[model samples]
Target: MKTNHPGPLVGILSARKADGSIAGNGPLFIALQKKLISLDGKSFVFIPEDAGIDHIMGYTFLPEQNHWKKEKFRYPDIVYNRVPFRKSEQSEQCQQFFTILNEKNIPYFNPCFIDKFELYELFKRHSFLKTFLPETILIEGKKDLFLFQKEHKSIYLKPTQSSKGKGILRLRLTDAAELQLDGIHQHELFKSFDHFWEKYGVELLTKNYLAQVEIKSAKYKGNRFDFRILAHGEDKGYTVTGVGIRQSQTQDITTHIPSGGRLLPYEILQTNEHDNFIEAIVPEIGMALSDRYGYFGEFSIDAGVSMTGHHYIYEVNSKPMRFDEEEIEEKKMEQLCRIFLQLSDYEN
Candidate 1:
């Protein structure tokens, strides 16, 4: 289990061969490398340096037809596990590299512990969260989707491993010929299950998708309000750093920032009386998760509220977006750095 990499190092693993967030989306991954470089100690980023690495060594692997043919690295201190991730498909190369890390016992910021569906399994166990969680069924085709929709009327289709509203669709019925989707509006209204199966059969077949009955989300401007709860692992526990609401702008079903949503102050999330309700509830949920989900202290849980005033957890992110100041603040970065050090010691 020994190699030549130095102690307390950070390796930002990339799951994807090419990503749009090579710079903007990889702050913590980049910050860990920068912190290493500033120290008079040996440090290097293991990806492409121009990908916004300030002081760390950057490494790269050549790709041929979406395959990592050749890779170069001297080894790393700790890995941030910042791999570009696609939930539905696992690349053989990514699987191999992950195996290598596992065999090596390298510390990872967010260890490969859980996936989206497993998180749902965890969510269903929460007494308070279970009711708000829509009746969900993993479906292979429109028959399954149609059965759920026939009863629920409105259903949300999500990829097994998705982020930022990509491949998320809300289906509704109308008297027309195609199905009406969330962001796309009332464009297609599927008249029969066969029609839907013919159009989106491949997506339903190959992709691991789940269908959940839609919740009438807590509304702001008749759209929806969702809380992006940011928490981090520290000695005290998984602490709720901040809770911001992502209110969908217009013509969007989700409140994800990349999908035409804007962040609002926490207070804007509730009325004067309900603000205290929110404050009280968030801490309780945070405490429960910290106790149960061993090692995952830092994350963001996307929560939605229904018209009936119930809060539903949409998704929980193990490796969340770093704060705007994480790059500049040394003390906070040090705390996060410590978490990486502790979690990386997986063998212990």
Candidate 2:
């Protein structure tokens, strides 16, 4: 939709409370708004409830005055979606907005939710990327678990669409041949594999999971850690804007910072060679995904380094959470501006 705003109007779409205020990640929304203004661009926050075919009522942050100003705005030129939860993003209004934006040709970042199982299949098709991926298989039922257990001492059964290390089951076979199931909250030990199967039973078969051989990752302060490479797309190509290390806070499966994890410098895990290798591959992965599923403005790729220095990709986040570092945060803002300006330039 056309707008009379002096600068290109960008919209930060998010989930809101009953009062029409953005509910989650308030700092991120505010940082993005101020950053856009710094680049002589304007943006506002809009929720699904405020969105309509022709216009949307949104809230703009005035950094100078340090407050939000409400206004009725035309459909923005570009929408930076940060709706945290998948269910909220999949709501009827959000789904309808996606269709409307596509019909109007309004560009958006991370246009859709991508499943982990599908992503694994995509990565498997590329021979060159095989070394960077751990052995992974889609778990259909009990059979898949039994087969995976036969080969690996430890394996992780993760939901296809899960976050924050939630609902992940880590199965380990000890020297005594005992089966142990470890999760965020629950931990159980069984004398036999059959006994473990009988305990979990049909509950395991109902959910979609990926059976992946657990990597012996590099550890810092006794906790396993991984690197998060934040990459953003520009007119030229995809660029690695920032990198950081996430160390697991507990003995859990994932090192997601939100799950009691701590942020570390990217240098702690990577050498110059490792950085170069990752930087070279980041754009390739971005392009490969884009070729398969259209354009994406950004992605957070989680990669793990083994004790022997071998690196492997663990996950690809379409909509990533904000990093705690100020430098990384600033870089993210810069990338956001690049995405908005580049798309706006093309459309005009």
Candidate 3:
């Protein structure tokens, strides 16, 4: 890849595998590197522990060799945080690396993961956006869970720091006055609140969990469905990159693919009303997040339309995973490259 006018040097901060290759989605990174190269730009993947003040040990894809090659590079003009896990991002080494980037005045977006409880609180402060959020409360004791259940009848308990529909449980009050609990792997019923708390709710007090009202999402052919909207920041504000639909296979508690959900054709749910609704909300959500959490290059929103025809925002991921849809993935790569160039002030 050769060009007379090359773009800026961008560094992707991520984890390293045992073999020292960059960890996470290799295909996504390879594709991104190729896209940057097409624009005559240079990019590399580096771990926080390997980053230095002057030069960092990093890996760049060698198309000729068809593999990643390790090398040393100067601090990038801009950095994109893609650290694979929450624990790794919280390490001392990662903190120190960011300090170095700050000292050198290098720009970076999405510094860390966003906590679900904190995000809910942030949305509550925004009057317009708050209405779209489900009523959420941090679970501290059995009393909190009981009160929430009594109010909503059915609620979802979610780990604040988890993703891919992990550690989420749905609890509903049956007409028989029993508690019905449904998890990804387990389903059971309790005769009384005490029984439920003794078995499950007691453990939630020890961890960070949020109790949220469950949205009765609209369904397609008896399967609950939702939309994943990818957005990227631009000079003016944020723009929607692409939208993909995920439908639950067995009408499960979540529409996440890992939790037995399947991706459907984008055209299946496309409509003028849906398009207009998304257009009205994406900019507001993006700007609100930026104001509260600093600039974010890109983020993905998990949202659904209720059976009552109202839209609800379920989750926002700062570090988004790879979209399965080909068109969505392609658009994401292109938009991300554009954001990198704009942030680095690269003249393409």
Candidate 4:
């Protein structure tokens, strides 16, 4: 049954700077806190470094007084993780903090960071989801790369655990077997496969990466484009909060907006058929992932629509990016708060 309370207390978790100020998207946190209150929920920023077994040093913003304040919040009903970097998320303090929460039986949404290769394998296990995923393989060594290149003339090498299009590479083979690599800032050419691997093979083999067959992604004005759809989940199901198209400014391997890409309205970049397909699949992927991951609040799925109308889900981000507009961001925050309250109600 639902609790007879004014609101549920939601905690926004993130790393803090040495000075004890919140790091990673401070403005977004502030906006979310304000929006949470408006939705009849309370929020505070929980810095993992300052958290103890008893309580955490929570930061609260006071819009009326035009200043910030700190308080000792014993704990929140739910935790919304916004920890930006994987390094920080894997830190000793952060791990311990989460362990403490788990021990206390406190629930968290979007529990942990999802790895690219791990997510791909999870989807591959289910036939329904496998249809939407591209042919992806783990890049263990040069042999795997050779097999992939022989089958697909063009491929993408992406870091298994990365975001914002960092360390992504696009490689293509010419009719003469010449290899070319296109990076975010520059491009390089190799005389042959042997030469290409000899120079960069060791570096790649040492790191975790995924080699995927390149999708014939839909394009606008010669630039590749894809949909970035955000979905929020509840006990009943999931809802698509927002849908927008991201077009690459350059011919890069990824279309992440922060990687020099621009956002466009869905209608401008998609046809009615494409829009309908996305609308149907967005919730399917959301619910499927939520069921698999156990409990998740929101997911930002990057899906590509081929010119021929075949839809492919590029990836699912647990911690998705927020839109620039205040209204849209606020709406997302509201959805998050509502989901927390729904879950709290059920648990209570």
Best by TM-score: 3
What's the lDDT for candidate 4?
Answer: 0.79
Instruction: Estimate, for each residue in 1-348, the C-alpha lDDT of model 3 and write its tens digit.
Output: 213346788899998666865677788888989999898888898898887668999999977789888899988888999998888889899988888888887889887888999989988998888888988999988888888889999999999999989989999999999999998888999998789899876568776889999998898998899999988887878888889999999648888888889998768899887887777778887887888877788999998899998888899999988888888899988988988888877744
| Clash tally, candidates in order | 24, 0, 1, 0
Q: Alpha-carbon error at 247 in model 4, in Å? A: 1.0
Candidate 2, residues 1-348, lDDT tens digits: the string is: 234554578988888666745776778878878777766678888788788779999898888899989999988888988777778888998988888988998888776667888888898888767668889988777777797888997998888888656778899998888998988768899998899889875666676778899999878778888888899996757898899888888665778766677888887666886787688778888887888877888988888888888889888888877787789888888888878877876234
- For all predicted structures, in order, the TM-scores are 0.72, 0.92, 0.95, 0.92
**lDDT by residue (tens digit), candidate 1, 178-238:** 5676543435656676777777778865777888778888788677778776666666555
Candidate 1's C-alpha runs over 4 A off are: 1-7, 15-30, 35-43, 47-75, 87-89, 99-104, 113-115, 125-132, 175-179, 184-186, 270-297, 322-335, 341-348
What lDDT does each candidate get? Answer: 0.59, 0.82, 0.87, 0.79
Please identify which of the two predictions, 1 or 3, would achieve the higher lDDT against the true structure. Answer: 3
Over the stretch 8-54, how does candidate 4's per-residue lDDT look in tens digits? 77888987666855687777777767776776677788778778777
Which residue pairs show backbone clashes in model 4? none
Q: Identify the leading candidate in terms of lDDT.
A: 3
Model 4 spans > 4 angstroms off: 1-5, 17-21, 325-327, 346-348
> Which sequence of candidate numbers ranks them by lDDT, best first?
3, 2, 4, 1
lDDT (C-alpha) at residue 173 in model 1:
77
